[model samples]
Target: MTENPYLSVFTLTKYIKRKFEADPYLRNVFVKGELSNVKIHPSGHIYFTLKDDKSRIQSAMFRSAANSLKFKPEEGMNVLITGDVNVFESSGQYQLYVQSMQPDGVGALYLAFEQLKKALAKEGLFDERWKQRLPSLPRRIGVITAQSGAAIRDICSTIQRRYPLAEICLFPAIVQGPQAAPSIVKAISSAESYGSVDVLIIGRGGGSIEDLWAFNEEIVARAIFSCRIPIISAVGHETDTTIADFVADMRAPTPTAAAELAVPSREELFERILDRKRSIYRSFSHQIKHERKRLTTTQQSYPLQFPERLYRPFTEKMANLDDRLLRNKNDITANRKHNHERLDRMLSYYSPLQRIKEESRNMDLLVERMTRSIQSDMCKNQDNFNSIIRMLRALNPLDVMERGFSIVYKEGNVVNSVNSLKVGSTVQVRLPDGTVEADIKSIKMKDKEEDSNEQ
Candidate 1:
């Protein structure tokens, strides 16, 4: 069997890539398609798919080429693209390496502007709630535009003419082409860095939407939206609209109008001040007349004309109240006397003297009972004590000794038994009056009858 394969998958893809690159028509092809799945890289490269109704092709725009684009590329935009068509080696598919792109029919800038407007609006960037109010009288006006452009001149001149005290500081920027958006953003940042601008005028002279596209850029719109200084957007003619107009603090018809919005006209202000003075005078006159009428009416009124008459009702009412109070006081005194008499009678009826007498009798009785009890307790205790003392005296050997009985001791111990006395032992004899020390002569055991009787 012969081998069926002739080439690897990479070899076929390489061949196709070489064929695509070598073709003269594919080298620089112009195609028109609607953009889809567009993605912008942080490195400024662009990746997107170009699609018509029936077919699509992958496309890439490098940073170098994309950086030159006058408009931001967005999805679903019908655009004319110029690029090289070649097979991407990794994907093995032919795609466009985009060099440049332009809107097919509608202006690219207008499409970009509308697309950005919709996107930013969806993100709540264009909400009226986020817009700041322009200062009524701005002290410092920051102008962000080309210093050479008519916008700065118109703004400065208008501000000077309308309100000469307004200090104008210029932040020079590129107002057209690809560099315009970043330049304007940097200018705004620079303006903010200088730190004294009360209001900012961002604009360019009348031009095409493409010429004013920098104002439409997302960066510029965000910069305008984020500015701490109130911003007035003036781009192109009155009819021209951009994203900057939507996000700025105020949108003016033209550069001159922006300056007018930012600063008040001195002449008009002076006229307003005059009108205010006239109004103040009229108000003062009216107030003075009204107050004078009030004062006159007050003076003519009965209370102010006759001071004693004003107090007549109060005096009469006070007299009536005093009369009623006197009557009430007398009645209250009578009633209080009656109540006091009734209370005294009740108190007498329930007086504690009887209770005290009864208590005293009961206390006396209790004292008598207690005295009898004490006397009986003392007599009984005395009898018991006397009986115990008699018993003790009867049992006492000292009493026996006083009755002429003696106590015999052998070596300071009692000799209760005859066996306790040893012959020839010295002994002590204790009588009631004195003690005798004697020598033991004999000791004999007593009879059993006598010992038993003694025990």
Candidate 2:
């Protein structure tokens, strides 16, 4: 059998890629779809998906084509894309190589506005913490917009009507088109160079997003954020907002509003000053009245109106105290004289002769008491001795011998039992009258005759 020739997988892929290149329709195709998974790489290449409700295709825009885009692409945004459909040789995948793309339904300017707004917002450029405070009353108002436009005219007239004393310095700028952003920035820097303005009114009259896009430029947003002078953004109508509005210190709906915000009304300020002056005068008057009333009361006080009467009571009180002191002194002297006489009599009664007689009598009484105590103690001891003598006689051993019991002794030691004596031992017997000496003979036991320990 013969083997049939077959192509390799890579060869088939290369063939499909070549077919895509050769087909004129696929080489230059137009696709209308909603953008999805849109991503712009650091290398300036854009990767995204072009999808309709029913289907989607992988799409890519190289850096060259992407640089020409005036508006940023976003996911879920409807767009019309011009590109070539081809097979990615490496992966064998069919995809779109996009060259040009523009928003399909919405204006490209609006898309760019939203895209930059989102990016700056994420960067915290729109944070309220970064917003500066508007000056209460600016000395010179710096206006950054076209010189001949209605925006500048409105701002100047409004300031003149509300606060006529303010100085308006116009930094004439191109307020529309590609050159508007840089012109506005240069004007801002110029205003800063002069350094006379207290606050800046950077805005234009109401216009479309494209017409007002100068303020939406990134340079303008950065300039507003970095401005030393406070900025009041007045761009477009009340319903319109831009990147400049978010980055500015304050946002006014109109150029007139922005001018009003930069300066205070002379009428209101005058009224406020008058109110404060009236308050201060009222306080001063009240204080003066209070002090005057206090002075009147002091003048009518008792000490000031009746000085003689005030001292009369003190004089009478001093005279009464003098009389009482004289009486007290006379009584004190009489009492002292009586006490001295009593003390003299007491000294005479306690003379030395009388004291000696009393002491000698006390000594004689003490000696008699001592003699009686010694006699009573001797009698008590004598009676105790007689009673002890009777007890000793009752307990005498000779008394027991008189009852026919005798105490035996062996070699001068007392023997109370016959078993205590051995044969041929000399013993002494103790009787009531005298002691008799004897010798111990042979011992014999009488059977059943006598047991001294038997019951």
Candidate 1, superposed: residue stretches over 4 Å from native: 1-13, 34-77, 90-92, 302-395, 402-455
Error of 2 at 123 (Å): 3.6
Alpha carbon lDDT of residue 225, candidate 2? 86
lDDT of 2 at 355: 96
Q: Report the poorest 10 consecutive residues by lDDT, candidate 1.
A: 106-115
CA lDDT scores, all candidates in order? 0.88, 0.89
Evaluate residue 243 in candidate 2 and report its C-alpha lDDT on the 0 to 100 scale. Answer: 89
1-455 per-residue lDDT for model 1 (tens digits): 99887998899999989888789999999899999999999999999999988999999999999987767887788899899998888878778999998998976666666778888999998899988887888788888888796788888888889999989898899999989989999999998999978998888898876677778888888888888888888889999888888898789999999898898999999999999999999999999999999999998898787899888999999999999999999999999999999999999987899879989999999999999999999999999999999999999999988877898887778887776666898888998988988887877666889979999
Error of 2 at 266 (Å): 2.2
Off by over 4 Å in 2: 1-24, 34-37, 51-56, 74-78, 86-94, 103-106, 306-455
lDDT (10s digit) by residue, model 2, range 1-455: 87868889899999989999999999889889998898999999999998888988889999999987868887788898898999987788999999998899777777788888888999998999988787777789999988898998899899999898899999999989989999999999999999878999898887777788888888999988888988999999999998899999899999989988888998989998999999999999999999999999999999999889989998999999999999999999999999999999998999889999999999999999999999999999999999999899889988877889898888788876667878998988888889898887887655564555563
